[model samples]
Target: MSEQLKQQFTKRIVELQKRIDSIHHDFANGRHADWSEQAGERENDEVLNALESEAKIEIQQLSNAILRIDNDTYGYCGTCGEAINEQRLAVQPSATKCIKCAD
Candidate 1:
């Protein structure tokens, strides 16, 4: 992989990590509501929970991508051992498999 692409992916992963940290902080600081607001609070909490879960998964993926870069394995399909297309990497920097192997 080009140094430029690796740098971009690294920057993206760092940004994602920051976002995850913010979500964690928000979730931790969430407040309990009064009885009258409990129902709405529950619904909002559910949505926040879902968002947190998604962010956690993305953080994991980005972490793995960073590891791959460190190992000199970035941009290679994990399943097929082929060079992953630049377009695919641009769209999903954490992709482990090429489009064919992914299918």
Candidate 2:
């Protein structure tokens, strides 16, 4: 990877880490439980929990992407070894495939 791209990825990884930490803290404090008791609230809580779980999984993927960045493999598609497009990377820094391979 180019030094500039690596730097950008590192910066992004740091930002993601901060966000993930904040989410963890919020969840630990039961902040989302505030909505667990309104009308139709059980379903809302289920959806929110599912979304939060997905976010946590994505955060782990982002952390893995940071490792790949450090290892100089950040922009390579995991499925086919093609170079992942910069635009795609900008949209999803944790992506492991090129658009074609992803499709």
Candidate 3:
């Protein structure tokens, strides 16, 4: 189970890293000749920035989860030091809190 969870976390991290790289590539190559198109791209910048930020934060959370798994502490809640539900972990592999602590 630990190996499986570690693989899952690693897979998710790869996916998020790809998304972040794609976002960075888009930002780097943003170019529009038309004024209206430039304005539209600028408008899209805000959305892209928000998305990039969200992806980064999720990546950090997943990385921390991986660390916990490595330290033999992955299934425990960070807040209450109780075992997190297996169902919850199945649903949210990156979860760091048990239901009681979450509430």
Candidate 4:
């Protein structure tokens, strides 16, 4: 089960990295000549920047979860030291805290 979770995390990490690379590509090489159109593009770029930041953070969290799995502490809550609920883990395998402590 832990191995399965590790594989799942690994897959998500790859997906996020791809998305980040695509975002960087967009940022580096595309723009309209007209100032007005460029302003609109800048707005879209800001949203992409936020998404890129979010993906980076999630990647780090998933990386941490992988470490926990290796250490045999994958299912335990980081804050309360309780076994994380199965349902919660199903929905969020990289979670570091149980529902109680998370709340």
Candidate 5:
């Protein structure tokens, strides 16, 4: 991989990690607005929880990508051991499988 691409991926990973940390902080703080006394509070909490869960999954994927980069296996299909297409990686930096393998 080119230095520029590597930098971009690294930057994305850092941003994702920061977001994940923020989500963790929010969850840890038990952020709720008088839910016992307010209507729709449970729904709001559910939405926030769902968002946090999605962020966690994305963070896991990004972390794996960083590991692959460290292992010199980043742009390759995890299942078939083939080079992952650049376009796919550009669209989804956390992709673990090539198109065929993914299908």
Candidate 6:
């Protein structure tokens, strides 16, 4: 990858790391307690829990993307070993497959 693109990806990865850290901190500190309490209905709690779990999973994916960037593998399709499109990377930094391979 070009140095400029690598720098850009590094910056984005750092931003994602920060967001993941914030989410973890909030969850650890019980920041979502109010939401859990205000759920009022069992269904609401269930929905909220599911959403939180999804967010955690996404954060882990972002973290893995950052690791890929550090390892100089970021922008390469894991399935086909092809360069991932810059546009697609901009839209989904954690993506691990090229368009064709993804499809």
Top TM-score model: 4
Q: Give TM-scores for every candidate, taking all chains together and pairing residue i with residue i.
A: 0.77, 0.62, 0.89, 0.93, 0.72, 0.62
> Every model's Cα RMSD, please?
2.4, 4.3, 1.3, 1.0, 3.0, 5.1
| lDDT tens per residue, model 6, 1-103 | 5456556656755665666566556555542356666455455546656665766676677767767877889889999999999899888878999999999
Tell me the whole-model lDDT of each prediction, alpha carbons only: 0.81, 0.73, 0.88, 0.94, 0.78, 0.72
Give RMSD (Å) of candidate 1 vs. truth: 2.4
lDDT rank, highest first? 4, 3, 1, 5, 2, 6
Candidate 5 per-residue lDDT, tens place, 1-103, comes to 6456567766776776787677667657654477573456556657767876787787678777877888889899999999999999989988999999999
> What TM-score would candidate 5 get against the native?
0.72
Per residue, candidate 2 scores C-alpha lDDT tens digits across 1-103 of 4566557656765676676576556456543345545445556557656766776677678668877877888889999999999999889878899999999
User: How well does candidate 4 score on lDDT at residue 91?
Assistant: 90
| Candidate 2 lDDT score at position 39 | 43
Indicate whether candidate 2 or candidate 5 has the larger TM-score: 5
Clashes of 2: 0
Candidate 1 segments exceeding 4 Å error: 1-10, 28-33
RMSD of 2: 4.3
Error of 2 at 64 (Å): 1.0
TM-score of 1: 0.77
Error of 6 at 43 (Å): 1.6
What is the C-alpha local distance difference test score of candidate 1? 0.81
- Between candidates 4 and 6, name the one with more favorable lDDT: 4
lDDT of 1 at 48: 73
The candidate scoring highest on lDDT is 4
